[model samples]
Target: MSNLPENSFFESLKAEDLSGVAYKNHLLKKKVLNYFSNFGNSTIQDLSKALNISTPKMGQIILELTENGVVQDYGKVDSSVGRRPNQYGLNASSAFFVGIEVKKEYINLGLTDFKNQLLKFLPHIPYNLDNTEEALDELCKIINQQIDKFNVPKSKIIGIGINLSGRINYKTGYSYSYFNFSENPLSKVFRTKTGFPTFLENDSRAMAFGEFKGGGIVKEEKNVLFINVGYGIGMGIMINGELVYGKSGFSGEIGHIPLFENEIICHCGKKGCLETEASGRALISKFYKKLQEGSQSTLSHRIKSENDLKLNDIINAALNDDVLAIELIDEIGKKLGRGISALLHLYNPELVIIGGSLAKTGDYLFLPIKMAINKYSLSLVSNDSKIVLSELGEKAGALGACQLVRKRLLQSE
Candidate 1:
């Protein structure tokens, strides 16, 4: 179906190379956009070398693409000894994909092109995790409205990527948590409800993909591990530049690891799980219990009821140096760090990223995390992994969902 010229060498893409529906027939155009999508900004000479064509021929194709609004002038790059060459980039308007990250409190929506350019963003849309139909109804409404506003045909949107917290079987696309959707695969339900091809992934794994490619760090490294600390702690492991989902897609359940021997129970019915002692939910519960036991604080008056308390409230309290809040967070950090050290011993990744809501606590969390790693991690691999905070903030999961569709469309396998 390619619009490639009769003499063109580019043939049909292999069947295994496609995950979602193909959008266009311009093989050369697809290749050009794929090049920019993978390598970011580049000059005509660079495209020529990748495509194995003369610069003049590349220029001619680029001129056609620019005139059609598919390519744009990125800017001029100064040459070492001559006139500067113009750099080119993909026009953001040419195509787009949908990414959605579902949290218990709200949902984040994003739109991006093949170049991984985020054309629009929407955050903090209220959603109730208990009612799947109501949530899906509202989600479709929002996505349809955005597509109409952008004037892109639904057919051109390669897919919609869904990232959520839960035990997800990627092959079956069912979750053992949040909406659990036993009647059909969650992605199938989403696809049927929205009329877009759908891909589903764990939230932490999705964020790892986004940071790996869209965060602009994929080029220099081949191994990474992302530890997401939120309502629960989850791990996303990447080895040799590819994400490892493990057998049955439930590999990174770090929160369920029995790191403590205490009597506390986890929501998953496991006793003494890491999440029972270290998760954000655990932090808030511990803080509230202390308050109930007559511990005084400046926050006591502000929080008239337990219903008004949230993880953000505790983090804000800590930022203001509330002694009680700091103590609780430090405890959570130590428990979290113990789990991280276990990962360090098992994976030996080059970089370990701390992401999700708690990552915003900055050094308050890292100090304890590093201390625990130093005390328990094997010296051979602990020093090899560099632990740092995620720069993508709360949007990491949403953007990572977008990366799923982009990678699928381009077949980055």
Candidate 2:
């Protein structure tokens, strides 16, 4: 029932159906594959030391893996006084995964191999989110184009992983906030249309998986939180090393939480939401509101229309000591801190990650956040959690989706 198998081998195959010999073979093969993936072209001793097993044992696993075509020999590495040992690596080209990030205005598609290398990525393909059928058609078209561009056999692709904006039910594969399909679930429809197995996840949850697997400081830490401040605000929670999906699979909708009792309505049919105050949209809105009132700003000449205004314009201006830009970002950071304070008191997470576009502002954004949290939250709770900016930028959701596909494939195998 566990999604992340720490040992890598225990969940490789079905326990009830596997004989002793068969299960042992599966375990060794999985171990060898995992070792080779982490260290490309590793020798028997290299794998042995990493896995804390004997060289002979590693050699046995490598031989079995190589014979079964899961691994391939990469010549020999000299052992100084001793004879050379053959190095091995996974058959990276044997399997491929497709990950898609779907948004209101655009979609991003990425392809990764068994080695978890992002081989190809197509960014910002425009589409309309409200039209379910048209959206599905566009998705299929883009996927086919990429598949043709890569010239990959359809059979070799393991599965397609999709991460989208909105609330999703893990059990039923339905997104309540978007893609209100009347006939079938998005996953089922996508799978039927594409003729490939598919997995769907909340965009924030997918991004958190990317951080959990590589980006954030979650190594050996159990509780973590990933807050995405893109055009809008979103959050993903990880507790006890597992992504939290509450009863309805919608636990981390922090942006919609009404932090202030104002008339500013949110897109989610709510008033005074945190996102309306602290999100990138809010930042832009605030800046424009001041500009319209004839407020002096260095960005006035550079920005032609509201369309030309982006977060980077504000961030660059702030970095150049522009008081207005810095002030706006600082205000947003304080709001973010308030939201984070609530999370700290509730979850008491070990690490909290700020990701997405606004996170690119780095310390300018973080300093104010730290100050706000310190002022609002209990020292005991705030001191326990360390907040850091996410290393993975826009690629988090797509990469995490592909990684999830790889994980499912490994468990099924």
CA lDDT, every model vs. true structure: 0.78, 0.78
* TM-score of each model, in listed order: 0.80, 0.76
Off by over 4 Å in 2: 1-68, 71-90, 121-132, 215-218, 297-323
lDDT score for residue 251 of model 2: 84
Clashing pairs in 1: none
* Residue 346 CA displacement from its true place in model 1, Å: 1.0
Which stretches of model 1 miss by more than 4 angstroms? 1-33, 40-91, 145-156, 216-219, 302-307
- Clash pairs (backbone) in predicted model 2: none
Query: Compared with the true structure, what per-residue lDDT tens digits does model 2 show for residues 71-176?
Result: 7898988667778888789787766788888865677788888888887777767765665667678777776676667667665676789887778874576767
> Model 2 misses residue 151 by how many Å?
5.7
- Candidate 1 vs. true structure, TM-score: 0.80
> How well is each residue in 1-413 modelled by candidate 1, as lDDT tens digits?
22222222122222335334332335556677678876777899989999787888788878877876668998899768888889998777555688988876778888887577777778777765554667667766766675566556554466778888878776687876756545888877777767666788899999888888775444477798988998888888889988888888987899999989988889889899999999988988888888999897668987766766788788888888888988888889888988999998888888998988888888888788888888888888898888888888777788889888767655533
Best by lDDT: 2
